[model samples]
Target: MSITLSHQDKITLHTAAHGAVSLMVAADATGRPHRAATDGSIALGSATGLVGHVLAEKIKDINLDGKSVAELADHVLPALTAAMSLLKQQAPAEAANFRSTVIVAIEAAARTHQAQPRPTVTDMIRKITAALDAA
Candidate 1:
């Protein structure tokens, strides 16, 4: 049977991953001139934090019996999808760019987490950023 982490441990893990994601996003969110590798770090950082907050509120219900990576995606994907939809409705232009990047990042993260034998917060963020860079 899979060992369950204490609530605090789970929070710590989420926080670490979220922090990494935020930094990555902010590095590329400079807008207009689009600093690319730099501006997104801030935006990513904020987005991860927002996702973490949502996850924090729903932590107890997150099923961990399956893969931990899938569990993480389950916690964060819906929020990301909703955010993307909301952005699309409120800011079509921004959404065009954000949607692809966010979706790419999340998918890459999920893939990386699934493939890795021992996934870490840094690993997930790096994979996501690498995917974003490739895109």
Candidate 2:
């Protein structure tokens, strides 16, 4: 089945994905784990004024079929590209890091899942952050 997301959905997802990378950077800067930072950040609603609500809602609305991770990446490429452009301008290093982290995460997730259950945004974030930390 073909998957579709609205422009707002894409933007929200992009923000959340970027936020995940930002979270990793914050954790690295503070010498903490991504999970810890995620907890503290959520408790403080650090992203509340930015894209929290939209991210949560859009995540809930997403439903993935039996698509490959590469396909999934392709589906979101446009949104990712747009976000990367802005990120590159604001924080080039973080943008490069986010790009690498996301690509690796997608490939690993696809390998791990194969064609079983579809992946969720939360799952993707968890995997991505874990992979980032391990690397």
Candidate 3:
């Protein structure tokens, strides 16, 4: 099915996707945040379909900047839920696609190191997943 998203909708999707990666990077306590960001971004770039198209754009309206993880989550978590809610309303398939894409990116970020994700990272992932599923 075809999906029509407004400018705000597009921004929300973009922010949610990238913000998820940023959260994962922040969750890293191993000083591999840069690598996590890079890997997560690569996964996002590999996304296909409408989610890919939306993410492939050059962002201008997104403001993922946050002095703390809490501040970032305040913006991104809701965006995740909103994006999912909107997609579910307009295109159920795209909703699932978006969820999968975000999950892959986060997992890619978490796997940046040889060891398993830290407990903090795991908690962050849980929070992100909850936000995604909150829709």
Candidate 4:
């Protein structure tokens, strides 16, 4: 099925996808947050299908400039769930694409640690996964 999205919906998807990387960057404690963010963002940029088109847009509507993790989560986690809910309603296959896209991005972000991700990073990943599942 073909899915349509309003401008706000596009923004929400962008914010949710990129905001997730931002969250991972924030949670990185190994002092390589930039690398984590870069890797995660690269993963998002490589997304396929409709999710890719939406994510590839140059959107300035995203407002993830939160001062703290809690502040960021206030918008991101819900956006994650909302993105999933919307996609699941309009395009179930794309919903799965979106979920996998996000998970891959977060995993790319976490991989910056070389060994295992730190506890905080792992916890943040868990929260992200939970938010996705909450949809």
Best lDDT goes to which candidate? 4
lDDT tens per residue, model 3, 22-80: 99988874659999999999999999989999899887999899999899999999999
Cα error, candidate 2, residue 1 (Å):
44
lDDT of 4 by residue, 12-130 (tens): 89989999999999997455998999999999999999999999999988989888889999999999999999999989999999999999999999998868888999999999999
Error of 4 at 44 (Å): 0.3
lDDT (Cα, tens digit) per residue for candidate 2, span 1-135:
222445654453454354443433332342334543454334324333223343334344332221455444334434455545554555555556555545443333233333542335345555454533442
List the candidate 1 regions with Cα displacement exceeding 4 Å.
Answer: 1-67, 103-135
The lDDT per prediction is 0.40, 0.43, 0.92, 0.93
lDDT of 1 by residue, 1-135 (tens): 223345654443333334334433332233221233233333433443334333335455333232445554454434344444444444454445554445444433333223432334445455444433332
Ranking according to lDDT, highest score first: 4, 3, 2, 1
Q: What TM-score, over all chains together, does every model reach? A: 0.31, 0.34, 0.96, 0.97
Instruction: List the pairs of residues colliding in candidate 3.
Output: none
Name the Cα RMSD for model 4: 0.9
The most accurate candidate by TM-score is: 4
Give the candidate order by descending TM-score: 4, 3, 2, 1
